[model samples]
Target: MTGTPGTRTGRVRVLIVDDEPALTEVLSVAVTEAGWHPYPAADGQSALRVARGCAPHAVVLDGMLPDLDGIQVLRRLRYENPELPVLMLTARDALEYRIDGLANGADDYVTKPFSLEEVVLRLRGLLRRSGAERTRADDPVRVLGPLVLTARTREVHRDGAPVTLTAKEFDLLSLLMEHPRQVLSKAQILDHVWSSSFDGGGNLVEVYISSLRRKLDRGRAPMIHTVRGLGYAIRPVEDGR
Candidate 1:
């Protein structure tokens, strides 16, 4: 985790650094599911680059890297922002490894193959301690790539053009925006947007989703996507694949 002025964008940004591509993506998705922006880097150099641009509130750092070691990265990050919270992830659970990470400035430690839920909870705790936690419900504006929505005004925009949506459509779209990049099952969508577990809720979700796609993606790159049996997710077109 590191900070330099002029990088924050009114959202909690987390930096996830790991040499493994799959692990980095998983961590990024988990952070997004928590309603926070995630910046993923596959190596220490890449991590430093991202931190320079995002001013992340917290970091999930892998203990080993292809280039610099995790402890070295930790030192550089601390030099930039001593208050930034870091959750270390190490494949080696040896006592010395744990002590080294903590002595280097890690706020928390988690061994690899750890529970995703536990990592998220630990990050949340670190954020709370650093005065970086904020309720997503309190943010009236939601942004996903080129799409923007203002909850207070009930306004939706795609590339600066006003988009018209009905009450249910707005509710569903906002729910997706609230958890960008996170796949939401029909059951979850039903409970959150329709406030029901009725048998028809699944069909209702599909119908509204279709309508949203038609209206929001008329002549442009699609943002709303279906994930087959899993349900649906909305992401920038480039990343949807």
Candidate 2:
């Protein structure tokens, strides 16, 4: 899953730099699975060149590079993009080795032979803490089965038919569509879709949900379902499992 060099609009960008092709591929795959684009570079020069254009939201930098040292690369990266989140991958687990990477500029350090999932989680945590995801460009249009929603336009379509909605309706539908097949509780929906100072009860969510159901399921099988007293979830019409 190699990505072209440069910043990707409306997508979270992750740069994976490792001299080993196998390791770089593994990291890139994991990063892609996390729902972000992965840009792979094999050496320090390549990483810097890619970063110059990639403007990566986060970086997974290996401790050893064939050309420049990992710390040196990290230094150059920080110099350019000071706020870029970096997780250094070191083959050595020694205290001094770990300290050196962190002391320079690494936001975090991961030892080699590390769990692939751990590296992804570390990168996610770094992004969250750094507030990068929140500042990312508008979400690209999201598609799920016959349902399609465009964030930039705030428009939703069902079965190729347009559906008009209020501001609140659009927000609620967008949230559900963001996590299709995942149940979101009334409280959760209220917090995300409505204002925090919104004193309205869960009934507000129920009303909006009812409106969405009427608009989306008027002539189709129920795509939105309620899990007893749990919460509401949206799925593709044919995705019954």
Candidate 3:
């Protein structure tokens, strides 16, 4: 697979690791469709080599590798690139497998028989959360009172103090700040932030919102307001009217 510059977004390189050639080929196509370049590897060693060479923004790693187990590979990869987002793909559905993968530093995990569309969305979410996806240099820095967000720098400050956030938290807060006082539905948030259409059967969005409030709203009037049965919004402390 060759790296092609994206028409709309910057080129994002993704390493697809799987022993099955057929799966690798299909994943390469999916990666391309998702507007990313794919670097395919059949074994753990090959995966390491490709990762170092391509400097992929993310990786989809198979759990059961022919050369090394997924956990080992994940640890090795983390050592090489601690911030690189990795999504583990495996047939194992056991709770222990999931726990082990997460413990080893996988950014996300998916079982076999998963939807290709879902996989693409997960990859997109990972990229967004890790600040790997490029944005326009001219994007404006949003400011609502003391809260400040510079999209280009991926920096957020509250009351002139630097506030650190994970990739996902930063994206979620940015979306809310972009549309202050406007209630954004769960579907809208998931679509814009996670890049997924997964039904709101999960509380992932809510969890992130809660953490954002804790971090960004602490020692100040809450800006993140949850509209019951509607969604959430960021607004000034006064003038609920």
- The candidate scoring highest on lDDT is 1
- Predicted structure 2, TM vs. truth: 0.56
The per-candidate count of clashes, in order, stands at 0, 0, 1
Give one digit per residue, the lDDT tens place, for model 3 in 1-241: 4232222223576889999898888888999988776777899988886565445679999999999898998999999999989999999999999999999899899999888899999999999988777653233555564465767678876544678899999989888877878999888899898867566624889899989999988878888888999999888555353
For candidate 2, which ten residues in a row score worst on lDDT? 1-10
- lDDT by residue for model 2 over 55-162, one digit each (tens)? 568999999999999999999999998888999998889999999989889999989789999998899999999887786665465556556666777777664467
- In model 2, what are the clashing residue pairs, if there are any? none
**How does candidate 3 fare on TM-score?**
0.54
Give the per-residue lDDT digits (tens) of candidate 1, residues 132-175: 77543344666666576777788887654678999989999998
Q: lDDT value for candidate 2?
A: 0.81
**Each candidate's lDDT (Cα)?**
0.82, 0.81, 0.80
Could you report the Cα RMSD, in angstroms, for every candidate shown? Answer: 12.0, 12.6, 18.0
Q: How far out, in Å, is residue 172 in model 1?
A: 32
Q: Name model 3 segments beyond 4 Å from true.
A: 1-10, 135-241
